[model samples]
Every structure is written in C-alpha cells, then in structure tokens.
Target chain A: MDTHDAKKPLPRLTPDNRAFWEGCREHKILLPWCQYCDRPHWPPGPVCPYCFGDDLTWKQSSGRGVISSWVVVHKAWLPAFAADIPYNAVQVELEEGIRLTGNVVGASNKTLRVGLPVEVVFDDVTPEATLPRFKPR
Target chain B: MRDDVAIVGIGQSEFGRYLPISQLGLGAKALQAALTDAQLERKDIDGLSLHMGWPLGADYDRMAEVYGLEVDYVHQSWTHGRFVTSSLQHAVMAVACGMAEVVACITAISFTRELSILGGPGDPEGMREQGATHGENPVYGLTSPAVGAAFALQRYMALYGATSAQLAAVPIALRKHALLSPYAVMKQPLTLEDHQSSRMVVDPLHLFDCSLITDGAAVVLLTSAERARSMPNVPVYVAGMQGVRSGRSEFIFAPPGLGINQQPASPTTPRERDLAVYGRAGIGREAIQGFYTYDAFSPLVLFALERFGFCGPGEGASWVQGGRIELGGELPVNTSGGLLSEAHVCGWNSICEMVRQLRGMAGPRQIAGAEALQWGTCWGDSVIMRR
Candidate 1:
C-alpha cells in the first residue's frame, strides 16, 4: 500500500458500535434508536444520547438524506487525505432525524449545493473498515 | 458580584513562532508582564486561573512553579479556544467571593510548528463524540477546525443569500485593522479580490476566513473594585459576565444562532445571553462603544451582529457591507483584528484591546471616548467591561 494511503485512520470496532460497522460492511445503513425516547442518534454511544436510556435498538435506514451543508477542502490536514484535496465534504440530514458527514461522490463540485438529495454508498477502505459515502440521488 | 471585580492590567507574549522558548516559558512571560503592567508585586497575587487552549502548553501546576505564584484560589480548565471569557469569569467569581485577591487569568497557545488543531479519524473516539466538529464530522472530511466552521458559513449564505464577496469584507477589514496593531500577525492588506481568489480551504470560506495558527499568550489581572481604585493603571471593571452551554452536543454546520445548540435553550441564544449580561451590568446597547466578537472564523462576526441585535437576522451581510465593523464605524468589533488578524490568543486579546481602548492606551487603533465594551466566545460566553 502507498505510505499516504496507509495513514488513513480506521474506526475502532467496539461491542457497542460493532453492529453499525458490520451493517455498513454488508452495504446496509444501521443506526441506534432509543427505545425509551423512540429517536435515532448518530455516532453510537454506550447509552441513549437523548434520554440517557440504556434501552436501545438498531434499525436499518433507507440510506436516503439531503445535504444540509457542504464544503470543498482544498488543504489536506492528514497526508492520507492529501490525494483527496479539493474534495467535497458534505453534511447529510438523514430521514432518521440525524445528520452524518461524508463526501458527496458521483457528483461534480459545481453540482453540489445545500438541500441536495443523496443516498449512502459504503466504500471498503480497509479489510475491517467500510466507510459510508454519499451520492446524488 | 456585579461591578465588584475589575481588570487592573493586561499583558501578552510575542506572537507567531516561539520555538526557542518552551510553552511554559511563553506563559510565564505573559503572567509576569501582567503583574508588571498592574504594578503589583509577585506576592500580591493570591488567586490564579489558567486557560490553556492547546495541550502543548504548561498546566496550572507547572505554570505556578514557573511564575512562583502560590495562591489561595487556583483553577485550570482546557477550553478549545472557544470560551476564554468563561475563564475570565472564573477569576472574577474568585475575587468577588473574597476567595482571593489579585487574580491572574491567562490563556496561552505555544505551538511553534505548523501543526493544525484539526483532529482527524485518528482522534480518540471519546473526543470525536463531543459534537461540534468532532461529532459525526469525521466522515465529511470535517476533520479540521476550519472545515466545520466553513460548513456553517455555507449554510448561512445559502439561507440568507449572502454573497461570498460580502462575507469577504470581514477578513479584508480585519487585515486593515491589523495593519494598525503592532502585535498583529498578518499586517499586509487583504483585498476583497485577494480574499476571493485565495485558496479555498472550504468553499465559501476562503483562506482568509480561517484564523492564523500562531504561538502567543495574553493575560488579564483581576482584583476587587476597591483594590482596583488603588492600582496604578486605569481599571476596566468587569461590569457583568455570563457563560451558558445550550447543550452537551455541538453542531458545526447548524445555522447561525442555532449552531452548537446545547439542550434546553432557555438562555442559550446570543440575544438572551447578551441581555442577561447587560441586565446584570445595568447597562444597555446604547452604552456599548466597542464590540469584540470572536473572529476564529469571520462568519462568526455576522452571527454576533445579528445575535446582539446590531442587525436583524439575515441582514448581517448588508450591515457589514462597507467598513461598518472597521474602526470609526457604528461599532468597531475586534479592534485588535481579533483571531483573524491579531495573534490568536483565544479571546484574551479581545479583552486586552477592550481594556486598552477603555484606558485610552490603544495607540492608532484606539476608539476615543470608549466607555463600554463587550467581548465573548462564540459558543455563548458574554462579558461586559467598562471604564
């Protein structure tokens, strides 16, 4: 592997977050939903973020969302992402009432804008890591 | 504790790179300068509150050893350069409550290298989960501090139809003000065309939109109002100060006034928070002659303008179209060029400038007859300082 490519940071799989990553690896979008509050939270944690309830469940999302905001990063902070300079970083508000950050692939820079509709596409960066990306609907 | 506390002196370390001197050395320099500016002997200080933005600097314990300050009150909290006003509030509370006298509040950043504070996927998951830029931001390449704020600016422009050129005025104007400050990092003039043509770190946020990464430190000496009367220098009273966290989670791309919303927004909005501060101080908007909104990102100036009722929501672009925020304008903000132009000493530089302006000591950039000043962190820390 190229040295810069090797520098990409991978998500550490844990018992609480293993299911979400596994779902992504299988090309499915899974989010943790609080059974107590009946709302979904992104970036899964040990307890329900909203209500602080331990009663949580995972449900598959439709993988559909709209671009609430976005940016084109010209400078690369991490050498691993140097090759991806001038790439688009997008914030997508999923139908599940949560927003996630990812690049808008399969779309040109000029074509990207706020409220752009997109769907998730998982990209396997490493053997153990499959990162989720987004594409124009 | 309103009007009970006052800042007697302010000091700063040389900005930009300081590779030869350690971070502790830089902090000690600022602490000593503050004491000297206040004309207080080393033994006079009985309280200490240290605000370290970057972890590369010395902690409170080590700083005390370096400065030889043994105090009855001591506090050290790591704020991510977002809430230095809260650190000042800590010192004021200590002095007002009689816990200590002659409190020193200092914020120091001692990064000598070109390292960015932007954390990437490599950051501990615990840190990444804190929201703001870290929460759910790793995916979008929201890896850098500038990127998160850039996203917010994009949303604000999209919602309010603000042009990139209008927003560019902020940094350009700040550069103009920076030309007047001896401590400013970028003294060269920044034209609107230059800002527009500059490399885009994140779209709608040009290179000028981002703050400079420099090593610098600023300190403020706080004491009882009664003690301040006897101090050598003109005292800038801490009329009122307030810090509020809206929620545990922070959202970088959220719209203005809504970004970084803490849960239960009873007093989280800037207007509410400003009113709270002004009410406590028994002052109003008419009394404020200087405003120093955090300029970590220029778009924040727009947010502060609207939040403080300087302009209506979505009217910030038009409000600052000309040199409205420049010196001699309606309300001069960040007269020290703020984080954008002056050394990014967190918000301490703003407080320092406010004190000097009130004391009629800020050369060239001083706003004459400046009686009242307001400065704060973008994440909801408001302070009212008066002459």
Candidate 2:
C-alpha cells in the first residue's frame, strides 16, 4: 500500500478545501467549524452550511468514529483498483457528527459492519497526497 | 396548473444493446413516432424539454437543429435519472403557461457506446470540486453511482434486518413485466434464485439489482388540455406535480433520514410534505392505480415506495414481496419493465409506459381500469397523471 500509483484518482483541491487536505498531509484531520452555529460541517466550504455564516474556523478532530455504512466493490470499475477486488469502502460517522468516505484498512472485508468503532490512519500513498483510512479500534 | 396540460403522444425506438444508431438518430425516430401518434406535424412542436444531454445524449440545441424543430421555449438539465420527473414537469409547465404550444420531452441514450462514463475513468463527476451527488468518491475506489445505492441499502438492511433475498423481489417483479413488454430489452423471466446467483457488482447489490446498460430513446409530447381534445390519442392529463427535495436530511439515493452521506440517522415514515403530490393531484395515494419510478437500482424501487408513503421506513424490502408490486398486485410499478429490465432510457421509458397505461393501450401489462398513475423517485420529486 506504500507504493504510489499514478493511476489512482486523487481528490481535486480547491481554495475552500485546501486546508483540510493540507491538514491531512500533516497527519491530522481538520473540520470546518462555524463560530455562530457552534458546530462543524463536512466537505468543507467557505460559509457555514448550518447557519450560512461567514465566521468559520478550523479545528482538529479525534479521527475516531463509528461505521455508519459500508460497501465492498467487487467490480473493477477503475482499472487501478483491479487488484483490490472485494475491497471495502465505508462511511464513518466521526465524533464531530459529520460523515466522511474512506476505506477500512487492517481488517477483512467480511467483518465490516455498521456501528463498528474505528480510528483513522493516514496512508501517504503519494508524495503529495495522503489519504485517511480507518481501522478497527 | 392541475390538469391544465396533458401528454397527448408517447413514442420510443427499439431498445437494445450496442446499437449502431447514434443518439440523435434514435431521438429522431422517437420524435417522428410521437408526431405521428399525436396526428401532428413536426412543425407543431414549439418547445423542447430535454433530460439527456452531452456525453450521453444529444444537447437541446443539437436536437433542435438536427431534428429541424424550431422551438421557442426550451428546458435542459444535466444527464441524470433524477431529472426525468423534473424534465416532464417542465414540459407541462411550459404548455400550461402558454410558453409553448407543444413541448416534446426528449431522452435518448447510448449507454453501450458511452460505457466508460458510467463508472470508468472517463467519468469526472466524482472529481468535482464539491463532490459527486451520488456518494461517488473515486479516491476510495467508490467510483460508480451504484455504490451510492449500495451504501444506502447496506445501511438500510443493517437497520431493518433486511436480507438480499427480500431485495430480489424487486428485479424479479420487474422482469416479469418485461416479459410482456415488446419494447423491453430483457425478454426472459427472472427468478429469485437467478437474482441470488448473479455476480455482485457492489456488495448487497447483485448485477441484476442494477439497471441495464443498453441503448434506447423515449419521447413524450405535451400540450394544453384544451388542445388535447383534438389529438388522436387519449390525453393523459398531468394532474399533479412536485419538485425534487434537497437539504441536510435528504440523500439522492436514500429516503430522508436513512443516514447516507451527511443525512441524520433519525429515520421516519413519509411526512406530510412528502405526500404533497397526492394532494396536488387531487387524489389520495389509494387512487394511484399504478406506480413508476427511476429504478436505476432495485433498491430505488423500495426507497421510492417508502418515500411516497406506500410503506413505512425499513418496510420496503418486506412490503414488495409476494407479488405486491407486480402487474396485478396491490400497486403495480413500472409495468413496462422499468430501467432494470427495460432499456435505461433514463426513466423516460416508464413515463411512456404511464401514458400508455392511462390510455388503455398497454396490451398485456395494462392495469385494469387504470385511472391515475404516479412517477415518483426516491429523490422526492413526482408527477401524477390521470385519464
């Protein structure tokens, strides 16, 4: 998993989401929090999605959550992932109450289930891109 | 605008796989058939409500120019199944408002030709700055739209203790209807065992659970109710309409509060707001003799039933069993096979089937005394048509 393949798709970086990606590169999970709403939102945007307020800040998360939903890809829709057939992708409900999509590492696809406790582990797949996967805690 | 506009004509080209015909070519055949069915000339069409566009189907402007349709009013949306109800709603609105004389809701697809875009690298939807609407995160190898449905269904089964065998009833019923449909791409009857043994594309979603990647086109014509009287076919009045819902609680592939994407975990039955289409249509859900939906995946049919209050949350899997949604069941859905067994004309095929059912023209798959039918999706948009 350490070998970086050019074939794997990378998340498109934008001005609004740059910090979250940058935080990931530093091995930390950052979430956008609104000062007015006093809560964090997902897929970070400039304005607070909850209150539509401009007062927003970044905060570190515990990188801990429970699996809310999960799926195993049996088809190689992407050729780069052909070797990883039957691989699992999951939606983890983070401690901050926002969900993020990632893979569950160091676990068998058969054992994955909803409400399973997991913590994030950064995978520095490429020199520039580090994806955050999860493992059973 | 209730009953002010009606679908006077419905037509479609032969549905199949890897057809050599171009998208525009298929569209022309369907358009010609629609014009002939309505006993109207090509020049009568003054508006175009296009649901399919670039990369999958012809653009509105290209369709207008190639088909020689000189229209004034036009509505176009991106190529997605969620837009089918909205696209037809736009046509009804255009005709009711006197914006156009007759609007043609055009949808033509060549999925076999554009196979790469479905989930392959050719699809850039997952790489969008905001993110793909259907939970497509290619970075995690969740590249296809089916994965989104799988994600929702996986959670749904976990929450409700549903099983794969219960979900198989969906494709099995639809395949039964396809056997009676001349236009359906799949002519064979499907069994629960066949569904169980089918290869898995995404976990909890067998290959049969997904829609056909075949090629086809369907065209529908709408005009004012006053003008419909002169048409050759029976007018299927656009009795009621509602738009697609969106918010923090709604997920594109899941019913409200099923907890997919960022949706909250509190699952509830259909609220009053969810049943607005029934009131708008001047009928209750009981009056809806037949049902239709964007069955891109088998799970959508279940979610739609739940979204429309046909059943409570987590009950769709069990509710659809025992010939419940079949042709002569409590409420038949997608009598013309739907996207699952019928060709994926982006759900427009079901729309055509609706018009046919209301007209008493659906030969074998017709619902007895069918008066009202619904075209709703899991996304919460709907259009109800009545005879």
Candidate 3:
C-alpha cells in the first residue's frame, strides 16, 4: 500500500496518543507503560487505567501477539474499503498483556483463528500515517 | 424503587422503512397515543427522558417544543441503543422521586435517513480519539457496530465450538415471533435455511444475524404507583433495575469475560453481581416469565441469555435451539420481534411489548399469565417489570 489513498480513515492523533502514532511512523510499536505499576495499557491514555498514575512512559513492544479474536468484514462499510471486500481485522493480545486492533495481511481470511501467533508489519498508508498490520509468524 | 414506579401506558408509531413522516412527527403520534392510553393530558407530562437525539432523531428540547410539551425535568442520552434501559430507568427514578409527576420515555428513530452514520467515512464515532465503545476501528475497515458483534461472535465460536448453524436459532425464533406480531417489519417466516443461505455481512455474522435498519418511534409513560392506581390501564410495575456495566472485564457486545476489546480473556459464568436485579426485584431468575434484550445482532440474544444465567457460559448456542426462546418456549424473548425482526426503535419496541405482555394485551404473542418480564442486555444493564 502506498501513501496516495487519502480516503482511508486515520486515527486522530492527540497529546495522549501522539507518541504511540509517532512510534508507529518509525516502524515500532510503542505502548504506554505505568511507571508506578510497571503495566502497559491500551489506546495511550493520559493516566494508567490500572493505577491512575500520571507518570507513564512510552515503551517499545515486541509487536508479536496471538490473535485473540478476528473478523472478516464482507460489506464495504467504507467506500475506501469497497474494493477490499472480505478483508480480515483482528485483535491481537500482545505479549505485554494488552490488546491492539489491526488487519492481518499476507494470509487468507479463512486461516484466521483464535490463538494464532502473529507479528506486526507497518504500512505507511499516507504521509502522516503508518498502520501496524499483522501477519502469521 | 421496586414496584414504586409503574409504566402506565405504552404506544408506538407505524414501523417501516423511509416513512414519509419526520422523526418528531412519529414521536408526536406515539406521544399522543400514549397520553390517550394513560388518560392523561399533555399538561401532565412534566418530565422527558429521551434516548434518541441529534444525527438520528430529534433532541429533547426540539421534541418538547414541537410537541408543545412544557416539562420541568429532562434526561437525554446519546443516540445509542445501549442507553434504552438507562433512559427508561431515568424516567422511573424521576417519577418515583417526585422530580416530575409524569415522565415520558421517548425514543424516535429514522435509521434509513441517517444510514451514513451507521458506518463508513461519514461515521465519526469509530474514528474517535480514543476509539469507540463497540470495538469499532475504522482505520482497518472495521467499522459499524455489526463488526463489533462479529468480532465477539467469531471468538466465541472458536472458544466454545459453536457454529453458524446453531446461531441461526436466534433470528429464526425472533422471526417466528415477528410473524405473530402485526407491527413487525419482517413479515415472512425465517427458516434455518434462509439464515444459513443469507449473504454474510461479516464473518460469523450473516445478514440475517443483524438487526433491521428502519424507522419508528415508541413512548412509555411512567408515574408513581399511587398515581398509577387511578389510571385506566393496568400498571406494569418497575420491579427492579441495574445500570450498564463497564470496565476491563466488560465488552458492550459480549458477556463479561468473553474478552472482546480490553476485557480479560478468562471466561466467566454469570456472577452474583450480574444477577442482582432478581434479588432487587424480590424474585429469582426462575420467576422471570419472559426475556427481552437488545437484540441488535443475533449473537446478542445468546450473550444476553448467558449474561442473565438463563443458561451457563458457552451454553447459549445449544440452549437457544429447539424453540427454547420462542413464544410458549421455556422462556420467550422479545415477544414483539425485537430489533432483529421488528423495527429498530432502540429496544423501546421490546419495552412496549413487555408492557403489553404484562397487561395481557399482546394478542397472539402473549405469554400465558405473563406476570413478570425482563429487559436485559448483553452489556449487563436490566430493568424487570411485573404486573
């Protein structure tokens, strides 16, 4: 995928989530880790969800996980995706005990299953966006 | 507030697609009918609890203005189906606490006109700064609430060895109920073959598995039990209630611990906290004569059954089979077709059906001596009503 399709919906980066997106742009998966509890939370919240600690750090992840759940959307809910009918979306439980949503490339939709080991692959969909997709390990 | 507040009347507009009437017009029809049913004048309505608002339906201020209702209290939530119970609960609390004398729970939807907001680039909900509550991540083409349900169902099938054939029981039963309902959108009987052969909208979710996108409105009137005694209609008492659950262990479309989104992966049966509504109602789950849930998707019906402990974890697929959830079954659900087969009035249609069942007025779809019914959902909020 190239950086020309401007129709694709991109995540709205914010102060709480900008670091995570910046890390993705650098082809690395960064998670917000609670400095107090030493735990990682998802979606890059301002404070740790578990302990509500304001002191947090962005740590690089292994970008490897097992598919906790997956869905293959058959309908083109978005015109940008109308040509890619039946693409697979998955929730991968990263090794750091958190989950992330992305697509699974380089595999047939039929092959998706719970607990399938996978690793993330970055796709710079646009100049300012690099999506983290997964592939079978 | 068990049995302290009562639903005095229930009314609905004609349910269909692309109705020529505006949302407020549909709301007016239903509100007028509700006032007539309750034998109360519009002046008596001092409170408004609306579950529908901007982008899909009229807001409370607009409804009150257009309907000529001068109210002293108002409760309004975002335009989401999950707030159906919360909206009604607000009405009950308002009336019970004397914040208002008579509260009207109003829901009017125009889904056909607002179809773009359901998904696609036009939908901003999935593209929120922190993601959507229903696991919608549009960046990956995983948009629409249906995709959230599909994600949960696919994982559920893999973990429990359930199949698409077994999931068909939900829509099939609801379709059977719809055939009996005069106001149902889906008139034709749905067979297992139809469900199996329907085109897949998302993996593990056939087109039949999703709820219909249509237009309609429903209204329920609530007042103190003391006032309800003087009304013309039989009062359906608000027996007990619980609010929507949320946390790391909860998913909007799946039972607790089913592990969609950030929910913990450990599978769980219905815990005591989940069954608190029964105890608050001073009744057990066995006394629930019928079940009503937010059946936005067929998998939701199964998840609701499991959420209420009607069946054990992973047992909803098999438990819903063999007409178990149809009328006259072990426990009928959505006796008025629900959102799947009926119009998607944001589950208020089912709430109205519950009132009718409790009043023994549900022609051809009434449960025998229907004394108590439950309006619960996969998300864990519930309101039990009894005659």
Highest DockQ scorer: 2
What DockQ does model 2 achieve? 0.91
TM-score of 1: 0.92
lDDT scores of the candidates, listed in order = 0.76, 0.91, 0.90
Lowest summed lDDT over 10 consecutive residues: which window, candidate 3 chain B? Answer: B122-131
Tens digits of lDDT, candidate 1, A1-137: 11225566665576777898899999898998999898888667789877899999999999998888778877766666777777787778888867777777777889988889999988887777788889999
Point out the higher-scoring one by DockQ: 1 or 2: 2
lDDT of 1 at B199: 85
lDDT of 3 by residue, B40-153 (tens): 999999999999886667788888888898999999987797898899999999988889999999988888998876887767778676678788888888779998999999
Considering TM-score, where higher is better, how would the candidates rank from best to worst? 2, 3, 1
Docking class of 3: high
Candidate 3 per-residue C-alpha lDDT over A1-137 given as tens digits, one digit per residue, 9 for 90 to 100: 22447888887888898999899999999999999999899868889998988999989999999999999888978888887887889999999989999989888888889999999999988878899999999
**Residue-pair clashes per candidate, as listed?**
7, 0, 0
- Chain A TM-score, candidate 2? 0.96
State which candidate, 1 or 2, has the greater lDDT: 2
TM-score of candidate 2 against the unseen true structure? 0.99
For every candidate, what is the interface RMSD in angstroms?
Answer: 3.3, 0.6, 0.9
Model 2 per-residue lDDT tens digits across residues B17-115: 999999889988998899889988989999999989865677788888888889999999867988888899999889888899999999888999888
